[model samples]
Target: MKIPKIIHQIWSGIDGPLPQEFRSLGETWKRDYPDWEYRLWDNKKMVEFVKNEYPEYWFVYQKYPFNVQRWDAIRYLILEKIGGMYVDFDYESLQPMCEILENKTCCFSLEKEVGSNLFKVFNNAMMMSTPNHPFMQKIVKFVFSRTTLIPQYTNKNLTIFNTTGPYALIRLYETLTTEEKEDVYLIPAQFVSPFTGLEAEEVRLGVVNQKLDDCLDNAYAVHYYVSNWVKTNN
Candidate 1:
């Protein structure tokens, strides 16, 4: 079956209006794929939906930091429940998604490596899946298991990352058997994130004067790494 042409984004009401950069990104997608559905979920709506559908996780969802941390949980839940593409607001579409979504049950992007520790880490910033794909189901199960073992009041950054962010997703992906791995499509970093978190600063400053590399010639989208800037500035 063809993957549904639905794109999802989250912007809690507290975040205020969408910035011009994000607005431009949304416009780009709309212009490129007018037939696709663009669905935006705010904090209130997301909370209500989770409460009704996954009551076991509602407490953990409510307890997570209201910032981007909660999105770690929200993205998986939304995708598992409805089955579609979830793109971070920080990303821009360089090409249409029709080619990427064609005949794929699920797909994830590789993070640009920062060091030996982060090499080959898969990023959840942009993910596409059919509803209730096993990988997503495992992610939800991972969240529930972690929440039980770790106290929610802990405010440590690393703790939050491990619990709901790429750290957790990476850990789960590693445990899958070879046969299970066949179900997932992994996009190389060059396609989804040609720039690492460190290089994002250079992109922001306009210091890197170069054209897109051949590796990105067929990239479907580019994650601008705005979240890295937000965390750094904080």
Candidate 2:
């Protein structure tokens, strides 16, 4: 079955409107898929909607120290309630989303490794799913379970990654049965995020030179790793 042609993005109003850097990228997706619906959710609207519809999560959601965690939570909620595609604001589209969603009930991006590791990690930065897909429901439950038993951590990085980033998603995904995994598709890093977090700085500096074109050549969308900017500015 074809996934619904809806695109969702979340941003805190505190940041003002979508940054100019990402505007053309977003517009490109719209131009390529005129029939698709684009939905942008800001912080205030996200909180109000979550409070009314998912009251169980409101208490924990409000307690998150970083806006990124809240943003992560709401993306799962939105995708669970209304099946569609969720792309990070920092991503630039290189192709129509329909081609990616075709013949898939759910999809996730496999993140590029920043260091030596035996296992692959999937990113939550971009996801597509049909409404009420089991994978999304599982994520909602996982988030609630973590929030209810908040743990003490040494640093912000660990807390953030464990709470709402790719690490948490990877942990939950591992628990799924073989049958449940069949409906999900994992797109390679080359197709969504060719750069690892460590290499993201080069993209920001525009120092990649010729390698830039090669990295993006096979990607449907390139994730600019803008979250790295958040850490630096803070």
| Clashing pairs in model 2, backbone N/Cα/C closer than 3 A | none
Mind sharing the TM-score for model 2?
A: 0.90
lDDT of 1 at 205: 68
Residue 83 miss distance in model 2 (angstroms): 1.1
Residue-level lDDT of model 1, residues 175-233, one tens digit each, is: 99988988888877777787777566566667645553443576777777777324531
Worst 10 residues of 2 by lDDT: 225-234
RMSD of each candidate relative to the true structure? 2.9, 2.3
Please give, for residues 176-200, the per-residue lDDT of candidate 2 as tens digits: 8988877888887888888877566
Q: What TM-score, over all chains together, does every model reach?
A: 0.87, 0.90
User: Over 4 Å off in model 1, which ranges?
Assistant: 114-119, 146-155, 211-216, 228-234
